[model samples]
Structure formats: C-alpha cells, structure tokens
Target: MTNPMRFNARIFDESFLDQCDERISAFYLMWKAKCKEGRIPARSDFDPLDMVKFLPGITLVDVERDTLELTYRLVGTNEVAVRGNDPTGKKVKDTFLANNWEDVWGNYSHVIKNKGVAFDDSDMPNSNGVMVGDETIFVPLSQDGEFVNMVMLYSIQRKAAG
Candidate 1:
C-alpha cells in the first residue's frame, strides 16, 4: 500500500532549536557538534558518556533502505516504561504503537529523504489513565556520509495538568 508523503508531525527547520525545550535543544546541539564539514554524523560519532543525560529518552532506529523498513535497534528505558513494553528488535510497522503505520513511517522517512530533522508532538500511549504528551525530534544518522542508515530520536515526556 502506498502512503501519502505528508504526515501528522510538523517537520521543522533549524530555527526549531531556539523554540524547542532546553533539553531537546541540548540534545540537538550535541548531535550537531558531531557533524563535520556539513556531513551528517554517523552513529559512531557519538560517545555514550556524552549522551548520558538524554539516554532514558533516546531511541535508535535502523533503516532498511531497500525495503523501506524501520526497526527499533534500541528503545530507551523511559520510552519502554511509557509504552508499557519494550519495542527493541521489533519492526516499527508491527508495534502496538503503530496504530497507523503510514503516518509513523512517514515521519521517519521524511527525515531520511530530506536528510533533516523532524519534530513531533503527540499524546502518550498506554498512559494507563495518566495524561501525558511527548515532544520528540527525529535526526538522521549516516554511516557512509551519503545515505541515512539510522535515525536517532530524543523525546521529552510531559505530564498534563489535570
């Protein structure tokens, strides 16, 4: 089934850095620091210790270009807790979080296709009666410096005021 190119999330420009949450900005800054000569940073460019503060909310997704498939290589602890289950090693299209695979895939694919960052604001799933929302950023990671092989995600969960 072919899906529409536009998705629910609003893909932002670099200006998003100034308006996003400080934590998100910090994470983006860290990723930007890894870039050299305008090339997208590879996964190896990052040091785990440098990402310690954002680890709980981080996720690494592997992109299979030929098949347009996305798999969760690592799902952060905070993400797993919020979703009520770990999605690590599962294809995105098969996850319970994928109530709409097209929309979900659209967001990720946008990052890869454009080699840009995408920002998404959405209600939390499996919150078990707790009202919560998420502010997330999807960033492309290239292994060959030309093709996006993975996406690095960072999200901040906010509890809604009752």
Candidate 2:
C-alpha cells in the first residue's frame, strides 16, 4: 500500500493563479471547480466544444489500466510549440518526452493509482543544453468512479528556450 499522505494536494492557489494570462488561468479555475468531493472529473464530464477559448493549452491523455501506460489522445494547438510536434494517438514512451519518460511516467502513474491530482514545475534541459520550463497540473479522470482511465492537463507556461 502507498503512503496515505502522498495523495493529498495543496489548496488551489487563487492569488498566484491570477498571474497567468486570462484565458489559461480561467480555464484552470473552471476545471478545478468541476472537481467534486475531491474526485477528479471524468472525460465525459467535459465538453471540448464548450471550452473553445481554453482549448489551445489543453491535452487529453488516456490511461491503460492493466499496463499503467499513458497514451496521448489529443494535443492542443499551443502545446505544439512546447512539444515540438503533435503526439496524438501516440504513447508517452514513444515521443520526445522519452528523454525524461521515467519522470513523466512516475508522475502519471501516481495520479492514476491514487485517483488524485499531481502537479510539477520543472525546467527540463535537453542534450543541447536548451531548457524548457513548465508548470503542469494533471487531473485524473475516472469514468467508473474508481479507475483512472484518462487525464486532462493544463500545462501552464511550457515555454521553450527559457
């Protein structure tokens, strides 16, 4: 069994959140409000068409239960510049993210297994010494109210060459 304290997260930082550009910050606020009983909302709970204004930085990730692998379902427009390419319909192990795939997988696995949220802020450096700074929040989605089958991300400030 995992440590119980590991699943708890900090409160929604409303004050610091305002630092984000209006659209992206607003999107996070909305998504966070949808979370009830501290339970993450399922994919069906959201309608992409309704979030047009915030779609640019959004991405959907599918979780393979038995294997605990993550799959990219959608890669939004703004995410392209940060990702260097679209990764839709691809597995996390087969992409540029592979450079730090273990970190990526561990973070995702934590969220899926605990049915909780996970956030990270890191500056990733590549072989060329170029760094990509990012702050991301991963929201788990459980269609059956127990198993996390998917996840949604609002990757804030994933700027290239920071």
Indicate which candidate wins on TM-score.
1
lDDT digits (tens) for residues 16-102 of candidate 2: 353444554666677777788877777888887888876877888888879977789998786776656788998877873423566
lDDT by residue for model 1 over 35-124, one digit each (tens)? 899999999999899889999999999999798688999989988987778989998888835347666777798899988888876654
lDDT of 2: 0.66
Give the Å error, residue 128, model 2.
11
RMSD of each candidate relative to the true structure: 4.5, 7.2
Best by lDDT: 1
Off by over 4 Å in 1: 1-9, 96-99
| Colliding residue pairs in candidate 1 | none
Residue 116 shift from truth in candidate 2, angstroms: 1.3
